[model samples]
Target chain A: MSAALLSAEALRIGYRGTSMLPELSFAVAPGTVISIVGHNGSGKSTLLKTILGLTPKLGGEIRIRRDARLGYVPQRETMDPIYPVTVGELVETGRYGIRGVGRRLTPPDRARVREMLEATGTARLERRLFRTLSGGEQQRALLARALCAEPSVLVLDEPTASMDEKGAHEAMGLTLALARKHGAAIVMVNHFIDLVAEVSDQVIHLDRDHQRVTIGPPAEVLKGRGSQGRYSS
Target chain B: MSEKLALFAASWELWRGAVAAGVVAGAVCGFVGIYVVLHRIVFVSAAMSQVSSLGVMLAFWLVQAQAIETAHHSEDILPLLFAALFTGVFSAAMAGHASARLSDRTKSSEAFIGSVYLLSSAALVLVGDQVTRGAHDVANILFGNTVIVDLPHLLLFAGVSLPIAVLHVWLRKDLLFVSFDPVMATTLGYPVTWLRVLLLVSLGMVISIGTRTIGALPVFSFSVLPPIAALALFENLRSSFWASAVIGALSAFLGYVTSFLLGLPTGASMAATAGVFLLVAKGLQRLRD
Candidate 1:
């Protein structure tokens, strides 16, 4: 019965002594996609990091209902290929909340992992080493990992930054499907305006220099900003 | 002929304890090595081992000096355990601090580890001056001591290594996620700090327990070589763990057996054997390409 799936009231985020954005507020509703666009180092990633609890919120409060769970995909560059984890095991981590601590993954959890992997079109790579996968494959594997959590909210930071045009389109399609099919609130920070405009219902812009949050429809927010439209240099 | 047989027999009796140490050492090294290779912190493993040796040597010197006046029973063992524990805990803390303080500027894991190793080496030699005659044995301990493993030490090694193996298995997924992308793992709510601490502490325990039997130098070899071998051969986390464990145990067994026959140092021999496998595995990989 809440209007917001997740809400940040006057949130402040950044490293100590060098905060990027000013006091910010935003609300994400169920089954909606919000694309956060900003220039590099504009606290876009910082905002996502703070919201997902990767970093501390410098001020204000972040509130999530006890029943809510989150699945997150970090920037493509953030993941290194040295580790020898399989896609299946990576996805299985999403089900950590389903079972009790110290307990092994149940059959249901395993099935869910398989289901998510298949749904994300990464079934054949389930046994493949995560390090050996291509960039798009890695993104799909991460998506499978996120979906396995059965989360109420999905947060992705530049999920398709390194993908080909086709891969980017597929990623957007899958992301939109994830939100629509699961009724999950999707908060994604991306640089591609045209791709986001195709899938996202709303857009939020973090103006690092001006220190403000600009939220509106994708066309309206991106209209006057041209070339530098939100993510332009 | 009988003299040769008697020497062989004497060594075989020593083999009982050495063999157990070999198994424990292999398992611990292989398990901890995964993290070292993944995180590029192999030097931390080496430094921790040296620091541990320094602690043991210091404790031995204190006990020996005290025993000159009055024979110390619990006093020797207690100080040794205390020294190892202190070094393990402190080294981990120092490494953590260095890593955090220099995250964006530069990684300080190596610098911190080197400083700690140097400090420990100085402390060890300075304190070990008390036992002039036993310096040879102490030196061997720094390298390793397959010729003189006792039952209690073997049991201690097993007790420590087994729990670490189990912990690694239980936390397999989270460890994989953290190793792959700590940023994302943290966002997904994995306790990255505590996980790293757990890994470091387990590695410390392994290093401390195997200090005498596997020797500090070769103990780290097990940690580094086996994981690399596993990485080359396997793709999955569980597969890597199993493969590393198997290869580690095999190398230990082969090392001890070959040393028994050829009169080589077991620790060095085991490390050499593991290294050879790594070469062959890498060579095979090159051939495929």
Candidate 2:
């Protein structure tokens, strides 16, 4: 069996020195999808942020495979829409880690950006201002930005929040396809149980009532004896 | 009109210094203003300008207390140097305040910025009163007397601003990334905190030198309005940058000419011209929308 791309052992997540969720332990292997589902303020997004190292972990350890790259799709609401960046320019920022500082994008970088845009169905909106795009379009553009980096670990925060049913389906499908193609470990914070069960191999439910995390395969976690009943579609 | 034109031409040598100062101030502010606007730190810039002006006034007070015959030594740049130093100190403080985990504080960063602006303004007035001998200099510091800008002053402004501008252009992408999304920039291994501090330091240096050369109001206006106008007019960051510089340079030249022709204050005229550009650009944006 392949080694886990990302593993968190008894990880505690929070903000400003306060813990928000119970300790979580999980391991994500390549080409596998892990969904973090919880109620509002259940620290679902905080877990993702902790994994990306945006927020400091309150306790425990997170280990990523050596030389593993991380791609992040932050919540759309967190980004200010007033910035004057085009879809193409926004996506190109994903190359910053790959290209390093003070280096201009090469032709291959541009080609990859274009390919990602096309794959995410945002090629037509490449020249459009990021602020001007609709919610669905913006999500897809953000996904393209994340995918363009070719990360070994892709972490998305509510990738389909505020998206229509069809848009969410398409976005999830595209995400899964990219994960399979790259054999990347995919971790996402999702609220929709049906969508979570459809795409994720494992579901880590942050049961706010019990203040504990339950992690297992989707079938067992969603329908088995440990099922919380709050995740019904 | 011909007489006015001939008058401008006749004293072209004297006007040259003022024109150079205006152009440099406008260009530098235009370039740095993009970060100011994108990072949403206009209030910080405003407060810093006030603090810088207060520094100049304090320098004058100190020089006067020691009975230094500043009138005989009009060539002295000690005050400007002191102003820059004070501005740097204040900028460091502000940066520290911003970076502090202020979850326990009731007042936000805006409140701190507002308090700084008010306190600095009051301190400038108090210092200006104590240093009555430097009253003319105080007036010059408050509202710029750009017509009296000499070659040495213009050179001093250029010496500080030019290299900062080049460095900003060289690191424009990193700067923009850090400004636009600091968290993501950090995730990508960029030094977000250091970059933010660097940006504030550069802003402080510009305001320090600019307030001494062109006065506080004009420096603040130049550092704010042009980027706003450019952002309104252009959809792309590169276009916005270029357009902002052009607009700043043009506004400076035209405002100087207008001030000279109308017998108005040069700095206020320049600031007013920038405001007009902002309004026009905002109108154009509305029409497009």
Candidate 3:
């Protein structure tokens, strides 16, 4: 692999000083997808937020490439529907990262937004209010927004949490294909263990109740958990 | 009605400055208040109004204490300078408020806004008792007097608000992005802190300058009510802002005219007019629904 897009060493995740998950380390490179799966309150979110700089790290060192352009797709619920934003407008906001604030999007930026919207199968829904979209469509539009910036690293929180089973599979497949196409490193928290196991290059399973951190390719990391892993998902 | 119109037109020279001040106050606060409404910080604007009132009262207290001697010494800008400094601190506070979850906000963020409103309101009342030698009466000091607003004061009000309105419009996208999603905005390296500072500074200017002409009550009402009416009426953000500005200006104009015709107090008249707009907006929204 080329240089890693993001790496963490002996990193612990928690609030203040209390550690919820034990020390774990992993590195992700461009064009690769890393999926994190854990039960609710298992520190999956804390760890993701820790790496993404939303929350502070409890211990250890994490480094993202200095020049990397970061993109984020929070769960649809994370966005306030009261904002009165259209899908196209929401997608266009992705360009704000690349162009910097106070600068309007240019023609090339608009083209990229359209391309991403089309790629995510959200072109037809561009004019619709983002809040009015179905769960699956909202996720796809948010995906388009995340990709619109051509980010070097993308972080997602429960991108398909609101979708149906089939939609979940499609969303993950689209995510993998899109990340590969854009050569972006993907870090996502997903509830679908099978989906994560199917598409991810690396998997991080955080069992906070056990104070355990398991990191490896899906087969190697997931093979031993059997019923517990299945039950958790 | 024609007779009233004729009478009002005849008195336009005396009321023109106050009317112009009302329109500027309405438009600027209406624009800034959209964020205040959307961010669920109506109380922040209310509290900032009290903070600005206290600052102005402090200016009056300074005059009474012989801190600065001039013609109309209460017009001194020590309050504005003080307000600007306090608002910069609130920029950080609001940034913290923006980043916290809604569940955590009541304890962590809103409590601060509540504290400021209470403390500032109390201090302003205590200080209002000491200004024995100014042209401003205690009633006019707290509620403000657009009816008596002079040319220089109107110019000053416009001077402060217009530039802030232009900046808000110019950075509309960036400001919206930061307001809607501080996490992603910060991740993307947008200047979240500076944007918050700009927003707070704008709110401060609206409250401080506005209280000088229109008083705290109408300033708060203008900042909140027209935006409420606008948000209820428009589904588009830009439309909401435009409607808000227009409604605010109209309300101010109508309120000024109504005060003259009905012999009502100017501040109360403007606030009541905004209340009437809010009711009409609610009715239209229900009908549309």
User: Scored by CA lDDT, what does every candidate get?
Assistant: 0.75, 0.82, 0.81
Tens-place lDDT per residue, model 1, B241-283, is 7777777878887877777778788788888888987887788
lDDT of 3 by residue, B78-178 (tens): 65665555655665576656655421224467778889889988988888777674546556646655486788778878888899899999998888888
Per-residue accuracy of model 1 over A1-233 as CA lDDT, tens digit each: 56787888988888875677788777787788899988887888778877887667789888876678888876656666677667776777777656633568988888988888888899999878777788888888888888787878899888888676677888889877865787788899887777777777888888877867788788887777764322542
Model 2 chain A: weakest 10-residue lDDT segment is A224-233
**Of candidates 3 and 1, the better by DockQ:** 3
lDDT of 2 at B135: 71
For model 3, residues A114-181, the per-residue Cα lDDT tens digits are 99999999999998989999888898998899898788888989887866668788888888788888
DockQ of each: 0.47, 0.47, 0.63
lDDT of 3 at B28: 87
* Chain B TM, cand. 3: 0.91
Pairing residues by index, what is the TM-score of model 1?
0.90
Number of the top lDDT candidate: 2
Give the per-residue lDDT digits (tens) of candidate 2, residues B256-282. Answer: 888888899888999999999999999
- TM-score winner between 1 and 3, please give it: 3
Candidate 1 chain A minimal-lDDT segment of 10 residues:
A224-233
| Shift of residue A46 alpha carbon in model 3, Å | 1.2
